[model samples]
Target: MRGELTAKGRATRQRIIEGAAAVLRERGAALATLDDIMARTGTSKGQLFHYFPAGKDELLVAVAQFEADQVLEDQQPYLGCLDSWEAWQQWRDVVIERYEAQGDECPLGSLFFQIGRSTPGTRAIVIELLRQWQESLAAGVRALQGAGLVPADVDADIRAAALLAAIQGGVSILLSTGRSTHLRAALDQGIADLRGTSHAAV
Candidate 1:
């Protein structure tokens, strides 16, 4: 069950969440405080609680959801439409550039690690993000198959899953090593394998 908020109330809450997310990204989740969010969002303690109700832990979960949403939103139209090899390549470059620019700071990942994924809300947010991401990749593979670029018998789900796993592995490595090489290699190999399938079918 959720509390119903007015339009203005919703806007204020979202402002707080976005502000909190920015603060968390700038200053690691472990160090960010409620007062920091207060100053960032121009909200007082009462207003913050009026919106969040359950204190900082609750606000943290909201911020986690915001960050998770950003992970997909940052990819934009490239991730949405991957029908062609050119589109896939563009998407790959975007992924690499995004992570490289982001460096070791992953707001969502940090939040999960700090709070623990065992928290039901945090677990759901991550699970949903991956599911949606994988589905988008699957859709792209199916589009290629439809266009005769990929063999009709190819399994879009499995290919998409493998590619998605490769990306996650590369991103994990980048987070640890601060280099985009693994991300680039994984993407290149995944795309090349897909291309190979096309040639094999031909």
Candidate 2:
């Protein structure tokens, strides 16, 4: 009996969570409501409250996680297989295209900002996103090293972290100014640094 009840509850909760994310995306977090989720998911008020007893705040956390998952998801394939120069370039283009298309409407960033990323839950999500992103990038750098494309002593973690930081800075500026110059520069420099085969290395 308990097992069956738990499964049903989990399903209901996931439904509400997804519904809330859609609402937040379509209407923005500031305007999302319980009814909006109910309408989207066909769930009732009772169910929403059952899943997110704290109401919109709890649901927003779930949405934040969803968005964070998407940040990594958007860069799959190439991100997971940065084993070649071609793959790294493809990953870089994917990252640029994703952000460029989004322009200023960063739903994921909006969700975190609305909920206060400094909060423990949101902060953990942010940290987890960075950790996974950096890990993938670092793996790519290590792959390059193994390919004889970079010095074997290259510190993958530092390079990846620096590259990720530059990307974030570029994105933030792009979000503010609606320009891709910084994004382009960051990617070009990051890739150049990784390539290290350039005469600039001397």
Candidate 3:
């Protein structure tokens, strides 16, 4: 049941979620418990339950959304304005740096795994995030086309989809192997494919 929360109440609720995410990132979601979030946020059970009455599962979903926001947030400036090859490269590096720093601990992935990927709500969050991501990438490709850097018929959406899929796969491998080789390869291949289309158009 949603309450008409005061400003402070809203802030406290957000704090709880952020604190819980930190706990998840530091110690796997499997191990981080309600008391852990309580201690981390300095909140008592009464307040915690007031916000997340559904308990761990509900809180975990909120944290997943938070992490997903961060994934895009961290790539901003570069990701938001990819009008040229250089801009795209900057965005690519930003993504690489963010994921590299994260190492094998993908907070969003952890949330998905924790809740089971097939859960309708959780799966929708993932799909929506990917949709927005691909749209931005496709827009960047379209920008290149406008600037004569890529062919007019480059099928930006399809290209962006493939590139995004490759990046996700590369990140998976990076997590498994603790190496950046696959990430680099995926970005390189994606860029090269775009460049080829540009040359073909010329």
Candidate 4:
């Protein structure tokens, strides 16, 4: 559907999605209505349907994608460059800060729940988001290896997968308990273990 949009149409559609994302975050996915989104985006019903023919569900999926992208975007330069211990620490801090600020309200998670995670579009979005996130983590591990911070024999992919899992676990706990304690421990220990690998090899 997006593939067929003109530049202006794309921009308008994106505007609607972003506005809808904000509304979802503020009102929760289950409670938000198309009228709320239309008002927020200054769009009419016709305009909204023109972009998202499937109505609220379709818009929610688009908002979900936006939130998913934001999860990575919030990590910034630190996530992109983990060549040094300093960079890794920075990334850790940013990750902690982002989640803590967000508290227990996960817009992406809520959107998926409302849309049904089994839905093909929602499932693909989640899978792609995790794939990209894990790939970035793996690249960071490789960066550390290239810089001689981690031993060459260490499996970057496995290390990255573990770290990603730990982060997700911590996030799950946070969403359940509204505490960052587990998240902090997970990140601190994950990085510490990675650092330990270098010493272990020595």
Candidate 5:
């Protein structure tokens, strides 16, 4: 059922999801239970069911969406703008710092693993997240072109896609081996190569 919740209702719902995400992050999605979430959020079972009629699955999906947003939101104003080399470097630092701080506790990845392939909604959430992230990167690339930092002939979409892949690969390795060296290398080299294009075109 679609919720036409009041302003207060929306806040309460958001609180539940955020609290659930915290529980998942701390306890791991595989082990977290609805009771744990309720305790964390200070919500009763009835209140939880009111917001999530489908119970655990519905709530978990909500948490998944929350985690997806956080993946990008953590980068903040830096990701929103890449008008200069300095800005890009700041963004790269933010990315590395965010992931390193997160360490092996990948909230989104853990959510995906817990849900597995049973729910198509989870897959859709992931796809949308990647699309949005790539689009942001592409916009940054275009900004460089507009400023003549990157040659106009350079393919923004391709560059963004490749950069996104490199970041994802680095993140995977970080999760597996608990290291950020690959991530830093990928970002530094990718940005340097982009900067090189500016020199080559001149």
Candidate 6:
């Protein structure tokens, strides 16, 4: 649907999606309604349907995508540049801060829960999100190698995958326990281990 939109149409659709995302985050996926979204976005029912032909389920998927993008966007310049130990630490802090500020309420998780995680659209969103996240981490590792902070023999992809897994595990715990302890530990330990690679290379 979005692929066919003109510039103004695309902007309107994006506005609706962002508005829906905000409504979902505030009221949750289970309770939010089309009327709520319409009111929030100031969009008419016809306009909404024109943008999202399948109704609420389709809209939810769009919002899920938005939230997923935000997950990586929150990591920003720090994630983009991991050439130094300080940069890695800063990135780690941003991750912790972002999740901690979110504090157990996961808008993306809620959207997936409402949309059904196994649904093709929702699953693709999740897969793409993880793929991009892992690639960024791997790129960061590569940057370290480029800077001679990590050995040439070190496997960037493997380290990125492991670190990504650790972060996910920690986030799962945070969602369940409402604490960032595990997340902080995961990040701290992961960076520390990456730094260890530098020593071993020396």
Compared with the true structure, what per-residue lDDT tens digits does model 1 show for residues 83-190? Answer: 999999999989998999988877888999878879998999989999999999999999999889999988999999999999999999998999878889999999
lDDT of 6: 0.92
lDDT of 6 by residue, 1-202 (tens): 5688999999999999999999999999999999999999999999999999999998898899999999999999888878888999899999999999999999999999999989999999999999999999999999988988889889999999999999999998999999999999999999989889878768
- Per-candidate TM-scores read 0.97, 0.91, 0.96, 0.98, 0.97, 0.97
Which runs of model 1 end up more than 4 angstroms from their true locations?
1-3
Error of 4 at 136 (Å): 0.5
Model 3 weakest lDDT span, ten residues long: 193-202
Model 2: per-residue Cα lDDT over 95-162, one tens digit each: 99999998978888889888986999899999999999999999999988788777777789999999
Q: Please, what are the lDDT tens digits per residue for candidate 4 over residues 1-202?
A: 7799999999999999999998989999999998898899999999999999998888888888899999999998888888999999999999999999989988888999999989999999999999999999999999999999899999989988899999999998999999999999999999999999988878
Displacement of residue 52 (Cα, Å) in model 6 is: 0.5
lDDT of each: 0.91, 0.86, 0.89, 0.92, 0.92, 0.92
Between prediction 3 and prediction 4, the one with superior TM-score is 4
Off by over 4 Å in 4: none
Which lDDT tens digits does candidate 3 get at residues 1-202? 5568888888998999999999999888888988989999999999988998998899999899998888888989977888998998888889898889989878888889989999997999999999989999999998888888898878999999999999999999999999878998999889988898766656
For residue 55, model 6's alpha carbon misses the true position, in angstroms, by: 0.8
Error in Å for residue 116 of model 1: 1.4
Error of 2 at 12 (Å): 3.5
How many backbone clashes does every candidate have? 0, 0, 0, 0, 0, 0
Better of 2 and 6 by TM-score: 6
Clashing pairs in 2: none
**lDDT value, candidate 4, whole model:** 0.92
